[model samples]
Target chain A: MTALARALITLAVPVLLVLLAVLAVPADGPTCLGIGLRIWALFACAPATSAWLWWRQRAVPA
Target chain B: MIAAFVAVMALSLLIALWARRGAGQGPRAFFVAGGQLGAILFFFLSVGETYSIATMLGFPGGVYAGGEGFVVWFFGYILLAAPVLAVLGPWIWRAGNLYGAVTIPDFFAAHFNSRLLERVIALGAIALLVPIGTMQFAGIRLVLGALAPGLPMPLLLAGAGLVVMAYVALAGLRAAAFVAVLKDALMLGAILLVGALALLHWPIATTPVATATMAAQVPVTLPFALSTIAVQALGFAMIPQNWAFLFAARGPQAIVRAQAAAPLYMVMFPLLMAVAVFARRMGLPVDKPDFVFLAAAQHLLPGWALGVVMAAVVLAGMVILSSVCLAIAPLLTRNVLPGLDGRAQQRWAQGVTALFIALSAAGAMAQVPLLAMLNTVFYFGIVQTLPGFLAALWTGRVRAGGVLAGMAVAALAIIGVRLAGISAGGINPGLIGLILNSVVLTLVTLMFPRRDGHSVMAMLR
Candidate 1:
């Protein structure tokens, strides 16, 4: 993959996850559930993506 | 409360003095802790600087005023920022190490070999950051005045300024780092204690989990929240002070480790917002929404615990203020006024820190907007530099001319939109400016591509 493509993916993946989390929030259900989903996306999913990217970068020879 | 404040301030000063012990006398040590900060110290410093009075006071106040929506997006954005930092931080550190760069402009100067570009960036940084320092002072005054009404406001502001300036001048980033450990501890303790009390004393629910949903009283549109999260997270990583911290790391790996662990510290925010939501339910009488955290603490905890909470809040403000003052002073002395000798530059930085702190204190005395609003304006200005910085990192296409033009265009757009009160479908002005900044940067770079491959690109490899 090109560097530009890789950069785009790196930026897009977290944003996509956040967007999906926001979309999954029910309009009228328990607010705690919505809050939980948002927190999971930020604290869990986002960091996981970052760690994955870091690992990938490390795996590649400089 | 008074005794707790005094004790906390004394302890902070002692920590600052201790941090000053091994710090060598030089610009690098003063500005970047000699680029020798270990993982733990770097973690403390990064987290401490990022989560400031805004986290403790402004965040809770936002929840209190606007409901869970205000804080939920912030959480998302901050979490997202960590990963970006994790990826880019090491590269920045590498560049800094390669060039012996201390400030953001130092990186630009060495990379592009353009002192003119360095001075422009420095001037922009100083112009943008002085208001932010003033905002910190305003936040400190609010926290102190809410907790200890008996203390004189002017004296409190002056003292706060003096203490922070002394520590920053004496130990620089080391002082901010060491003091951050104490600030984070107190801040975490205070947040947990208040959150637990709020959960326990929740009148509406039989269990703590049931009360979590009660905080989502106000409805937030999905578009606004998502856009906010996107822009804010990006802006957070781009802030010049944050960049300085990246440079101060022992290595790229330390930054990644620190970024990974920083999220754990942020768990306190959701709990704090829950407390704020609970306070709103109880109809806590607060004239300002930012006072929700303090008001709830006063109502729920005993005087001693409230004192601890106040100390945490106040110290968070001071640590951030000190770090910011340290960050900008070097930009002023080293880049903006490059005529000074090494020793003279250090002296000038110290003097500038004190002067800036005093000026910020005086500004804080005048009535300003809420913490969150001031923060928005600050981020709007700072994030304009993002396109250029990213272009520098990713591609060798962009030049100093393109960067300067992008910045000028973005600044004008931000000011024009803000002054005219133009709303782009509820999108943040900063995001708008950043979009324009990227466009201008790309167009200009494509128009005037560099023939020579910069050495900075080789450093990145």
Candidate 2:
């Protein structure tokens, strides 16, 4: 994949996840599901961003 | 319990001593492990730092008090910090290597070629960092005092201070990193044990309302949480010890690789939140909200396990305390008081470390209200340097004068907004100041760009 492709996906996924989380929580206001979804979104960024980073720089020597 | 605690504590000392094998005699080896930490050691050191005493104690305490409102910002900041570090981490590593920078000020001084800028940055960092030391002690006082209620506060502080100082004296950053390998392990075990117990002993027929109430569910302040997370995540890259950690990596890839995995470490947050909620549900006798984690652990774990858990908490504070001292001391010895030979620098580093610990301990014991105020300004102050640092790396627009002026204005703006108590509609004061700082730095740089300088970006291109 191109650097631009990687960068765009890297940037978009987290933003969309966060936006979905924000809308759900405030719209629902305060539910356990809302809270869980919110936290899960934040946690999801770990793998999303990390995988992208690893893919982009996999061959770069440490 | 006391025996387990003592055993772990003693083991840490031995680990520090063991790290002294073939220790070099200079500020370089003493401060940055001679700039030779591989991905694994760097991972331990960096990941261990992100989970400081604040994370162990203050995080649960926050959840216990403010619930999801607190966790959002706290967790979000840390979660976002990984990506921030992943992107910026390699650049910082390259800068450190390119400039042979040990301290943040060392980077500025070399990049800007201005000793005065170095001193100014060092002074501001120490002001920001000293209170951080006090924060550790503040948490330490609570944890240690709870363990031995009869122990004198002064004596307790002195003993903790001595152990922290010894880490620096024994092997400097290497000792901290080496010990961090074990410290992080114990910390994870403690959290898992407490979290699992919270789940296993969880009331089987609890209602959603009760769970919500226990979690202290409130209207999440999205604006404040988002702003705070943004400034703090960006500023984490600029923090003094973080920069030191970046420099400690053997290479750019080492730093990036470790940071890419850092956010996974905070997976314990849900567990922390569970522990906090369990404390509330069980009505544990928590004298302070911050003690909720300890309270839960104490109630759930057996005596020996509790001791091991408490020992991990202590190391959490002490290792961070030692790391802060290690960061600040060199800012004084190497950057502020330059021209010291390697041996002299090492000696001065030790002395400065001791002094910072003592002064912080004293402030904590005295319970100086001013220190509390400084604590509020700590992040605000540290984040002011961000404009200067970013300018140093990617652009030639920021001259020494521009960076210096930007920081001065930003610091004043942060302090002023804070003193005036304008909530700015719940936005963090640091964010406001960072904006003004960036504006001034850019405006000034535009007014007076240097023709002779090229950024690392330009050179690479």
User: Best-fitting candidate, measured by lDDT?
Assistant: 2
Best prediction by TM-score: 2
* Least accurate 10 contiguous residues by lDDT in model 2 chain A: A26-35
TM-score for predicted model 2 compared with the true structure: 0.92
| Model 2 agreement with the true structure over B10-104: per-residue lDDT tens digits | 99999999999967766778788888887788999987756788889988887776745567777777766776677677777787877788888
TM-scores of the candidates in the order shown: 0.90, 0.92
Assess candidate 2 and give its lDDT.
0.78
Which ranges in model 1 have alpha carbons more than 4 Å from their true place? Answer: A1-11, A32-62, B205-222
- For model 2, residues A21-54, the per-residue Cα lDDT tens digits are 5556443334341235556656566676666666
Each candidate's DockQ: 0.30, 0.39
Task: Give every collision pair in model 2.
Answer: none
Scoring the B chain of model 2 against the true B chain gives a TM-score of 0.94
Question: Tens-digit lDDT track for model 1 on A5-46?
Answer: 665666677667666666665434445512444544444554
Report the lDDT of model 1 for residue B454: 59
